[model samples]
Target: MKSIVILIFFLSSIIGLGQDYIFLESKNGFREIKLGTSVENYPEFNRKDNSNAELFKLSLNSKADYVYVGSNDDKIKTAKILFIYLTTNNNVISEIKVVTEKVLNVYAILNSAYGEPSSKHGDKWIWKTNNIECSIEGDQNTIPGYHIVYKDISNERIELKKMKLESTKKAQAEL
Candidate 1:
C-alpha cells in the first residue's frame, strides 16, 4: 500500500510539471499568450517597423487550462494562426499551420478569452473570439478564414463558416 501511494504521488508530480504557459512577442507589433514551450523566436515573426510588438506577458491559470494573448497594437491588419502541441519534455510534438488569405483583423476594443466550464454544468469549455473579422477577395472559391476551437484534451478542430462583412458585424454584436 505504501509503495502504491508513493508511485501515485510521483506520477502526479510529473504530470503537473509538464504543463506551463509562455508569452511570445514579435518585433512587428504582434503578441500572443501560448501554452507549452514550443514557440517561434521573436525575430522570425517580428517586422522592423514595429518595435512595440517585442513585449508580451502571459498569465497561467492554476490548472494550465487556458492561455490568453493580448497585443499592444490596435491595428492588426492580418494574422496567420498556428496550433502547437508540446510533449512531456517541453518539446513541440506537432504543429499545424492555418492559412489565411483574407484580410483578417482582431478587434482592438475586445480581448480574447477562454476558460473551462465549472463541473456543476459538466465538462464544458468556452472561447471568445472577440471582434475578429475577415475580408476575402471576390474571386476566392472558399471562405478565407477558419474558426479554431478546443473540443477536448489533445483535440482542436477548425470549422469554416461563410458570411458577409455586414453579417459578421451583426453576429459579433449579438455575441
Candidate 2:
C-alpha cells in the first residue's frame, strides 16, 4: 500500500508527453490565431498576467507573450492542454505554442485533420510545408510536458518581418 501511494504521487506530478503535430499544411497558425492576422483581433494575447504560474514562467524569457485563453475557448476538449505562449511581429501572430498531457486524443484529432505526419524524429513528430511548420516533441525546458509549436516560416514573411524590425530599430536609433 505504501509503494502504490508513492507511485501515484510520482505519476501525478509528472506531465505526460505524446502526439504528432496537428493542423493542415500552409496553416501558418492554430485555430483562429492565424499568422499575418491582426493581434488586436484576439484579446486573449493581451492579458499578461500569468506570472502567478511560477513553473510555467521559468523556461521563458520576457519576449515570450504568455497567452491566457479566454472563456470562449472550451479547451481542446479531450486533453490536459494549455495555449501557453505566442509571439507576434508587425502586430500579427507569428507563432503559437502549447503544452499538453493526455495527448493521445489530440494525436487522433490531428491525424484525422492533417493526415499522416511528414516525419517522426525519435519522440518528436513534425509536419513541414513551404509556409509553416508544426511539431510535437518533448520539451523539458521548464516543466515536464510535450510542446506543440506552430510557426509561420514563409520566406517572404520572414524577410518582411526582418525589414520591419530593422526599420523600427533605425527609427529608434534616430532618437
Best by lDDT: 2
**Candidate 2 lDDT over residue span 1-175, tens digit each:** 9999999876654422112222354455777677767778876564455564553363632455547543434456556665456777877777777766645666656556666777888767777655777777764444455667787878667798999999999999999
- lDDT of all predictions, in order shown? 0.27, 0.64
lDDT of 1 by residue, 1-175 (tens): 9999999998876553322111111111123423223434322332112343222111111122212232433223454432111112233212211222233332211122112211111211222121111111212243333322221222222222333556788989999
Please give the lDDT score for candidate 1: 0.27
Q: TM-scores, in order shown? A: 0.18, 0.60
Clashes of 1: 5
Looking at model 1, which ten-residue stretch has the lowest summed lDDT? 20-29
- What are the candidates' C-alpha RMSDs? 19.2, 18.2
**Over 4 Å off in model 2, which ranges?**
1-23, 47-63, 69-73, 139-143, 156-175
Clashing pairs in 2: none
